[model samples]
Each structure stands twice: as structure tokens, then as C-alpha cells.
Target: MNGATTSGELRAHNRVRLLRAVHDGGATSTRSHLTRELRLARGTASVLVAGLAEDELLHEEPAQEHGRGRPTQVPGPHPRGPLALAADVREDAWELAACELGGRVTVLDVRPHDGTAEGALVPLGETIAAHTSRLGHRVIGVGVALAGPVRFGGLADIAHLGWRSVDVPALLGLPLRPAHGAGGGGATLGNDTAFAALAEARRGRLRDVRVGLHLHVDFDLGGVLVVDGRPLGGASGTGAEFGHMPLEGGDRPCMCGATGCWGMDVGANALLRHAGLEYGGGRGREQAERVLATSEQAVAACAAALGRGVAALVNAHDPEVVTLSGHGPELAERAGETLLRACEPRLMAIRRDHPPRIEGSALGWRGALLGAMESVFDVFLTPEGLGRWRDNHPDQGRDTPGRRNVTHSTPKGDQPP
Candidate 1:
């Protein structure tokens, strides 16, 4: 069929528009709200919702209101269907969560893993299988979040994991078809920091803020720039790799094979190292508490390094607010005053009229899970995304990964990394 005379094409396009509207407007509201926001007729809205409901992508519920003119139902959670496995891989531990449609999450398994070896893949695959079996076929997709830079084509550059140029999809294994009563076979992978920033910017803390910067300062320093509520994915998927940036006084070899990197000075490792503890992969929380407990020296250093990073981001993009996530917010609570103070010196005095607000992440550590869940919905739970997947790869449509989920475990018996 010619592109112009294609009924499938029209349906796919409309589906995408409707889903996009729902996404932009956070929680699903009333049908009239969707109609007005999307500029679609009432009948058209009804048809779209009906189609979405058929796919188990959306559940319409009676609106919580009195004297409603005709009975109107708001779009609720996705009908109980397949579950998606979201995995977060870090140096010392792995966390896998089971997420249902509309972003409800249930963490299934947590275990120790090689910070940097293919050996870690074994536990990850098992976790996926175990969770999928428990939840049954409702498992629709898998999303992966790694602790390092995921280069283009979903390759990870995890330093502490000692992983360089590791392909995630190949390592994580494919989603198996349900054995008996099981369901779901979709998958997608992503970077942990990138996914976290996306979740924070869109559904979490920075949602209402239009232009913002999200920084995850942990064992490493990673961040993303959000303009108009969408994080920028630069060419090669490294747009916001903030840790590798060079600093004047810094003098250590970074995992990215660079000297004097910003991350080495500000990340969780740096804080741990400064406190004279074991700077391994799993000591994130312990080290964080140490920073909070000690005489603000490590915290000051983190804030100083982070302040420099924020100032640079502000100067380059001039965002309205810089949202800190992961351990960044915890650090902020301890050293926010110092961070902002450092920012004042770094910012150009000439442009004192507008300085970006240095703020804590609203989503905390759960942002990655929410963001990864969005991709799952995009691939299976939404009318538009599912349609596109069906049209492009019909054979692999149902058995594909949508987004990667991220959760990391800290090692026990450590002061903190």
C-alpha cells in the first residue's frame, strides 16, 4: 500500500499523538481534559481510550467528583497485564524491580554482582526469570540501568565495574516466552544516570520546571540537561557526561582514562577516599553518612566540585534550576550552603541577574525506575508506541525490550565509597 493510502499509518500517528498528550500531562485526568488538551473531538478521544484499554494499556475509572454530568471515567493505571523487569547494575550489587504499566514498581530481587565483569550477567538473567515467573505473563519488557556511561548502541563504560565497551543487550540475555501461563517478551536498555535524570525531569521533582540540569553525584559524576522537559541525548548518547570534564587542580586518573577529571574530585569515591575508607563500589550510603557526620570537609569538597560543574552547566545552557539526584541531594542537605557559595565564585559576576537554582532531586533514587517504566509503556502499554513497534518489527514486536531499569546495592561492612 502506498504511504498516502494507508489506514495503518493514520491509526499509528493518531495513537502516538494521544499517548504523547497523556505523557506531557503527568497523571491521566478527565476525558474532557484530554480532548481539550489534544484538540481531539469527544468521539475521537473515546475511540482512542477504548483502543488503549483494549491493549491493557489504560484503565478508565469513575472520576472522583460529585454531580458529574454524564458518567466520566479518568484514565487510571494500566490494567493488570504483563510486568517489566527493570535492572540496575553497579560495581558491588545489582537490583531488579518489577514494574507494571503506568509506572507502579515492586522491587523483586537484590544481590551482589561483579562491579565490572560478564559474570554479573548470570544473576541478572536469573532475577528476571524469577520475577517474571512470580508475576506471570504480565511481564511485558525489560529495562536496564548501569552505573556508568552507556555509549551509543547501549554499550556501558562502567569504571568501577571494570567494564569498558560492554554491550548490555547481548549480556542481559533475551526475554523468554512464557513457559505455561506466563506472558510478556519486550526489552530495552539505558544508562542509569540518563534514565534517572529523565525520570526526575519529567515525572519527578523537576517536572514543572522547564529548563533544568540533573546531576547524579555518586561513585561517579553524571548528569543530563533538560530543556522543555526532555533530557538532551547528545550524539553518541554522551551529551551530559559531566564527570569526564577536566579540572585545574585535579590530579588522578579517572576510569574513563583521563587525568584530573571532575568526577574523581566530587563523586562518592572521592568522598570516601578523602575520609580514608575503602573506596570500593558498595560503600555509597556509608560514605554519604560519613560526609554528613564529619566536619563538612568532604562535603565541602563535593559541593565545591559540584558547584564548579553546575556553574559550567549554567554558563553554557543558562538553565533555570540545577536538580541534584542520587547522593547529590544527600550531599546538598549537608553542604548545600557551601555548594551555592562555591557557585557564586564560579559564576560570572557580569551575569548576576539570573543564576540557576541549586536544588535537590525530587524523585530521590527511584527516578530511574519510573523513567524506565515510561519506555516500557511507550513500547507496549501505549497505543502509539505499540503500533510503531508492530509496524516496524512485527515478528519481534511483543518480544522486545523497551527501557532499562536501574537499582544498585552497596556493599556491607564498609565505611562508605
Candidate 2:
């Protein structure tokens, strides 16, 4: 995908790499150090930075903390730079945010809706339309993190919300795609837990980890396997359904149409089941917190189940670490010891004393939204994607970076939302 055959292609390719370096480095990167990191000549780095500045993609200023000899240039997002809209669609509420490079995100809107597709998405679509219209072509793409498993082509099955085979893109009013290889400009749909796992790898506990398992446990559970700094998309882009793996071996008849799912004994529903409360979502999260606070027996049981099932996954995947998000942090805190006691013996005897750590996510609830932003940028930051962006924004050359009338995304690195 990065064959630089022509000079123009080579520039485009290097431009992407430069932007990625700035994004990954966040505020820590300087032009001088980027040259060393990318193994690019000083002049080439300067030229790339200059091109980006002139194109209204990025601008540089004198670095306060100088590296060595001369003053270094710190790259910052341009006022007119490309942005990605990240939406986290939950069982009860939806959150919309605008994001720029360097992993910055600003909450645009947050509201709950009736438990219907029309009620939930119509308002979200209206907000997206407002932002896109105000920002124009700088809005590159949109990414949605649904509380469900998303198929490779964006078919979603949100079992908790009682929705299946939902055409998410059409509902969100995404522009119709041209033929294949026509460049990237559309919405990216992915499972919430999978996207959260990616955010963990990029900016949270799983950062710098090679192989890691990340699970988001709310009412039920879902997950993704992050390997080599990337989220591994399994066959059909729907893998890591560890919750439905029957780890608990209970015939509780899960909402996923499965019997004996591991999720039956792990998430808020598991806690609620132990507490004699009906299973619920959204506002049910509040009920789960009450159970966690009041029922020690339920906490211990849930923790044990979480630990035991995680042990099984550790054996199967052998990840370096495991990160949990959503209500998982509280569960891990309340019964972490209990879970570990149940987990340690189940691992392969060879590594029983040194099993992978199970820690709460550093990104908290924002992981899914940030990961969705990364998904859009992952596609649209490429050479072809940028080419498409250029075609759409022909006036980019005449545009200048300005802060007036623009509310830039606040830079937040792994902070709780």
C-alpha cells in the first residue's frame, strides 16, 4: 500500500508518515526529533513540514523546550485541518465529538434517546450534519462505535438493544461510496469493545504492548485482540466473542441466543442476576453500581467468574497483558484479589507464577470514541485518502490557519471522559 513509485506518490507517502508521527507523538514531538525518528534528512523534514503548513494541514511554532542546537519546530493542528467525527452509540445514549490529529477530542453533543433506531440516530444525524456543514470539507470521515458486534461491511447486531442486521451507515446518512479503490470518505463502524481495545493499545494500559486482550464489560461484554500495535480483525471482522464462549458453563440463555455464555457471570447483568434484579442496560448501569456497592457476595462471584474466564482466554491467546474498560474497573477493584485467586491456578502451570496482568483501562469510557476517531484517520490519512481530500478541498492552498470562530478539540491523552 506504500509503494512510492513516482515523486508525487513519494511525497504523499512521506506526508502521511509525518502526520502520523506528529499524531502519535502528540505535544512531545518536534521537527528536529521527527527527522531522527523517521530517518528523514533534515531538509526533507523541513520541506514536508513546510508543505503541510502551506496546505493548511499543520503549522509549526518555536518549541519552548529545545532539543539540542537550534530552536525546534513543534507541529500543531491547523485551524482548517481535517477532522474526524467520532460517535459512541450506546444502549441508551449517544455521544458525538469532533477530533483532530494528536488524539484530541471535544464533545459536541451528548444526549439520551428512546430505545428506537429512529429516535437514537435521527438526532445524531442532525448533529453530524450541523458540524459537517459548518466545517465544510475539513470533515474527512465519521466513525461509529456501537455497543454490538459490527460485521466487516458495517452490518451491526446490537443484541442488548434488540436490534439486528442494522444497516448503520444508511441510518446515519453516510454518503454512498463509489466503486472499490475509489479512495476513503465514509463512516467506519466497529464493535465498541474492539474499538476500545485499539484505543487502549494506542494510548492506554496496552500502550507499547505487543499482544494484549481488551474487554469492555457493561451490561454484557465484548472484546478485541490487539497484536503488534494493531487491532486484529478476525474472519468476517467479528472475532473475540469470549463472552459467548461458555466459559461460565451456565445455561442462562444469553441475549445473544446462546446458552452457557461466560458473560452470564461477569458483567453488570451477572451482578444483577446474583442480586435478584432484572437485567437492563443504560440506566441499568446505575443499578449495577448499586449491586456492586451493596452486594459483596455478588462482587466476589462476578470477580471470580471474570478471573476464571480471563484465565481461559490467556491460555488461548497468550497476550502480554489484559485491559478491561467500562464497569470492569470497579469490578476489578472490588474483587481483583478474588479474581486473581481464582485465575492463577487455572493458567498453564509453566507460567502460573507470572501470569499476564489484568488491569483497568486508562482511557476509561472514552476509549471507544477515541478508537473510532483513529479508525477514520487510519484510512483517511493515507496517500489515496489524502488525494481524495485534496480533490474535495481544492481551496486548501488559499486557506490560512486561524483560531477565531473555531472551537478546537481539546488534547486529552488517556483521560477519563
Candidate 3:
């Protein structure tokens, strides 16, 4: 706490800040705009951009002529800039996408499988290996969004797939070793709904909220509470399994070997069950949707159960807003009032008068996909991370964030007389 901040450290911090601005802004920024946003001098901003351009982290081009001021430079993700990779492992399918700094994602591949651990991860791993091999120089890391709780390092118990304590890492080894990433950190595992909630916090319905509740109701209900823009994973990172709670107090059995689970009364299973259809592991999704679309009574019952559980959560955590994802929007649209009525009576008196607003998902299915991408980007976009990358991949253009090689001094008439 005594020594002055090193110039190298200061430059590193500023460079990280600049990269973060573009990544979060989800679009390109001009030199003047970035300068204003980062509260840096025009000259300083230009220098930072140049260094980043030299490192191939950012691409610069002439700004289109529109204004009377001097021509500004536009900075965006370089063609060879670091990329964030994400995968979604569903009940019968898996998907992969590559994302640029500004959160623009391009889905690479999606393939269906036989619902086995190998059936899912094998094809998925192959796709990732093939893609990252060509894109390895830019890939930072990969994040996989699975349907069920992911605990420890390798064990995954996905009920739909009947995958119990599967060793995922053994099947899917290191995916990439991007030029910036030192041999990569392998795949990070996150629950699908939690990842969707993360996407919500970053760019969707839950964005900017202090405390938010995100519920995803597909074949079953699952959710996470986002506080300070993060999903609250418990001590073992195996928490926020809100679906297992029994708010309805029914004796219905659940797939998790528990009885009277709140999940048994909502999601696609609930809709299908109410319609007198046998709901089995992700197979009833389409049928459940059809039933909800045709049977008003089915939607009403499912929404009521959803409302009761939501009320319980609201009472326990007191979120600012509750946003729904997966198939929740369609259900809410049909039975919104019924859901509200069930929620209203259950709330404690204080929350009754002024209740939290329940809204639909803004990003829809894209939430999970984008969340997976952001999860990995969150790791590699740090100042320390960027510094390590710049160091490992030296020979970058002229100036580096950790070193001062470019002259900052501008001649007297260089101010654009």
C-alpha cells in the first residue's frame, strides 16, 4: 500500500477497461466514444487502441464521414481476436457457438444424440475439437451448459439423459489452446438454467437489477437468484435447485427420487400430466406444448403451481423482479392472471401490497446460449488474464499494455491545426 502505482500496471488496467467496454457494450466503439466512456484523454485512448490493435485483440478502421470534427477511428473485435466458446448439452442434443468480444455469437454446430454420456459429449467434443483447432488461436475457453446439476469437477447427474456421476472430462479432454490462453483451462460446467440466468443478468430481462429471480420452465422448472449480476451457486456450487421444493404439498413423485416436488406440478411434465399424457424425459416437450396451446385447464393448473413456488421464493429472497424463460412466456401469456392470483394470496402481508413484477424472458432460448459464452468470457477478459495473454504472445505490434514503447508526445502542430 506504500509504493506508487507502476506505469506498466496502470497501462494494463486501462487496456482491460477498454476491452471490457467493447465486450459489454455489445458493439463497436469509436476512439472518441471510448475516450468519453473510459474518462481518458483522446490521445491516451488512441494509444491504448493502437496497442490493442498491435496485439491483434482489436481491429481498427476509418470511421465513416458524417460529422464536422476530425475523422475518428472505429475499434472492434479483430478478425483474429480472442473468442469465447460455449456448448449446450441438452437431453437429446448438443450445440456449440463462438462469440466475439462484443457478445456477437455465431452458432457453429448442433447435433442430436442417443442420450448417453458418450452419445452427447463425444459428438460435441469432436465438433469443438474440429472448430477450435482452426479457431484455436482466438479461442479463450469453452463453457458447457448442461440440463441438470453439475457438482465437483467431473460428475454430472442429468436425469433426462439418465447420466449418473458421469466423468465428463475423461470423455472431453482439453478443447483448445488459444494463442492468448495458455493451453486453455478445459470446459467449465454450469447448469443450463443457471447459465440462462447469467445471460439474463448480463444482457436480457434481468440486466441492471440489483437482485433478480430467473425461472426457466421447460420439461421441468429450475431457476437461480442473481445478486450483483451473478447466479448464487451454493457452497458446493450445487445449489439453486429451486425446482425440487414442494410448494404445492402434493404427494406426487419426482424424478429426483423426492416426493411432492414443486417441479412435478409445473413445466412440460405438468402440462402433459394434466392433459392425461405420460411425460417422460424430455420426450413430452412438444406434446406438452400442444396440450397447453389447446387445453386452457392444463395451462391454468400449471400456472397455479408455478405461482405458488414463485411466491415462496419471493418471500424467502425478496428479489426486485422475477423473469421467466424456457416455455414460461407462452404459459404466462395464456394464464397470467391465474398465476398472479395464486401468488397474491401466498405472499406475506408486507410483500402483498407492493409485489415484485413477474415478466417474460427477453432473450428466450438465446439466454442459455449467450450465458454459456459469457461464462467463459468472464474468466478470460480480466486485466490479469489479458496481461498474461499479451505476455505469452509477444511480438505484438508496437506498444503492449504492460510496456511503454510508443511515444505519447505529440508535436506542437500535430493537434490538427
Candidate 4:
């Protein structure tokens, strides 16, 4: 049998808990707020904050007085705290961002892509390298959100982009620099739609939801199931292919090697097809945007198909709500009533009266990037990782082997550098 927990272990656990509370609460989190949220005594919370500050993980500032209460310090990221780099790769564009601990994202770069996963690597690597060089040794890990099925640390297939069985980590060449903790940080990959679902669950509309669905309709429809604030990616990590479901009866073969895929009728390709524009690859999003801006009939068909697919998923999954991202929110805004009307005939009679609430994404275009940052934090914020970080930079002046001197600077906005 194992021995009972010691004071050191308990203190470490409480330290991680305090940091997590501050992280989840964002920049406005105060000492008193953390104390109440963690149900820790005021003195205990103070000690934890002091310890984190000493380790350069958090910074405290006098909070602005609001109502009648004693002044308290608001917690924020330390100047030398670890950072996360997030990348979102789409068909025509890619974005890279630097995210600090308190959830502040600074867009490092956004560049157009060649619509091919293999061709994207050179530029993607160059950009990541540039940012990592500038950010120095503070970057803890990288998270990538790809617009396709990711299987076992690689791309299973991106049908529209025509990529198959691509190794993403090999392509990106991760670990741009050494990490802060013992976990020896590298890169983490996820589906863009799943990452968006994670973003919604953590900081957006799905925060209050128990079971829900999130659909991001861009060049294609991609989504994930959010259960209890976690997006479930199945074995091999490419599970939630909700769009590939055969809800529409047709003979046309889908890019995903199936017939009558629901996605073929609900996204940019469908909208472009309805508008007599080209449907495959490259300019689908551009064409769909122009059509949605000019033509009403095309939008109507797309909206109807979108609603039908949503109804089918709802019937199968029984989620509490459905949140829309990418072009989904615009489609819902223009044809919400039509989408709801289309669902009425397909849903069960009991659900028809009280169907799942469909709403736009609160995080908007930044959902995937935010989720990518969250993924980085998820890997690095554990008790073991924190202990390693603390050990590497102990208060006693003896320099630890392999420890690099990380400089500090104030971050823009409320977050510390």
C-alpha cells in the first residue's frame, strides 16, 4: 500500500488548483475570487499566490475598487510565464497566434495557403520558427488545429485538399525550442471543429451546456460532440465525422469515399453548386461568400440542407444545444426560421416541440485558436509539470543544469508578459 499524502504533495496540488482557477477565470480573477472559488482559506490562497509569484507563473496587482470591500490583488500571468503557440490551418489560409496563460491571444501572422497540406508545411514551419525565435524560450508547447481528420498524430485525409496519411508532427517539425517542464514539450494536433467545440465548452456558449453539438461550416461542414465540457475524439483521434453521415439519399460519391454524405449538401460546396459555381477545391469559400452576398435562392437551399443535417444529428445524438461557428452562424442568422421549419418534419414529435437551441458561436473566428491554446495548457498545467517547472527555477540560487534564462516584458492588455 502507498503511504499517505505529505504536506509537500498537498501543497503542490493546491498550487495547481489555484493556477487552474486563475486560468479558467481569466484576467479579472482576484485573490478573494480564487479563495472563494477554490474554497480555500484566505491565508492559504495568499500563500499559494505568493508561491506562484515566486516561481514566475503568476503576477498580482491591486484590483480596482468596486463596491464596499477591502482591496484585493487580481492575478495575471507572470512576465516570464510559459506561453503557448496555436496554429489553425484551413484550405486557403492559416493563422498563428501567441497565447498567454490568462487567455490573451496575440495574432502573430495570417497568410494565404496553397490549399494543399504538403505544400503548407514550408511556410507554416517558417512562420512558427520566426515566432518561436522572437518569443524565446518561454513557449511551452504548440497546438495545431487542422481542417481535416487527424489520425494518430497525423492527417488521415483532407479530401478537399487531397492529402492522405500525412504525418503532421513530422511536417511541422515541433519542439522549436526546449520546454520549461519535465514533460519535454512538443506539439499537439487536433481537428479544427473539435478544437472549436472545446473553445465553446470552455469559454463560449457551451459553458453552461452538459451535452451539445458544435458545427463549423466553412468550405465543408465539420463538427464534434461536446459532453460535459469535453469534446470526445475517438480512438486514433479522428472520430467525430458528423458531416460524413449519410442523411441525404443520393448516388454522388463524397470526397470522404462515401455516398450521400450530409456535408455534400450543407456547406460552401452545396451553396456554390446551387449558385452554378464550381464546387471542388480552391475557391469554394470565396464563391460561396459571393453567392451568399448576391443570391438568395442559393442561400435558401444551403440553409435548408444545413437544417436537415442538424435535425438528423439531433435526432441521433439528443444533445441539449447546437452551437454554430464559421459560416454556420451567418446561415442561421439569414435562415434561422427556415432551418427550424425544415427540422420540424424530421425530428421526433416530442423533440419537435422542444428542439435543441441553435445559436451562433461566441468566440467567432478565434474559437479554434483559443482551443489550441487550451490544449497546450492542458498538457503543461498538471501537478507534475508544475513541480518540474518549480524545480528548474528554485529560489535557492544554485543554477540548475539545462536551465535557460528567460527574460520578461509586460504583455499588452491586462495580462502580464
Best by lDDT: 2
RMSD of 3: 8.3
Candidate 1 per-residue C-alpha lDDT over 291-405 given as tens digits, one digit per residue, 9 for 90 to 100: 5578478878887778877787678777778888777887778888887787777777654577777777777877766666655655664443465433433232132222332
Runs of candidate 1 with Cα error greater than 4 angstroms are: 1-8, 23-27, 66-68, 133-137, 175-186, 208-210, 281-284, 381-385, 388-417
The model with the greater TM-score, 1 or 2, is: 2
Cα error, residue 7 of model 2, in Å, equals 2.4
lDDT of 1 at 183: 34
Please write out the lDDT profile of model 3 over residues 357-409, one tens digit for every residue: 89999888778778878877777776766865677664566442321111112
The C-alpha stretches of model 4 lying farther than 4 A from their native spots are 1-4, 175-182, 392-417
Task: State the C-alpha lDDT per candidate.
Answer: 0.66, 0.80, 0.79, 0.79
lDDT of 4 by residue, 236-344 (tens): 7887688888877767898889888888887788888888888777466777898877777877887888888888888888999999998899888887788888877
Cα-based TM-score, every candidate: 0.81, 0.92, 0.88, 0.90
> What is the clash tally of candidate 1?
28
Consecutive 10-residue window with the lowest summed lDDT within model 1: 408-417
lDDT of 1: 0.66
C-alpha-based local distance difference test score of model 3: 0.79
Error of 2 at 361 (Å): 1.2
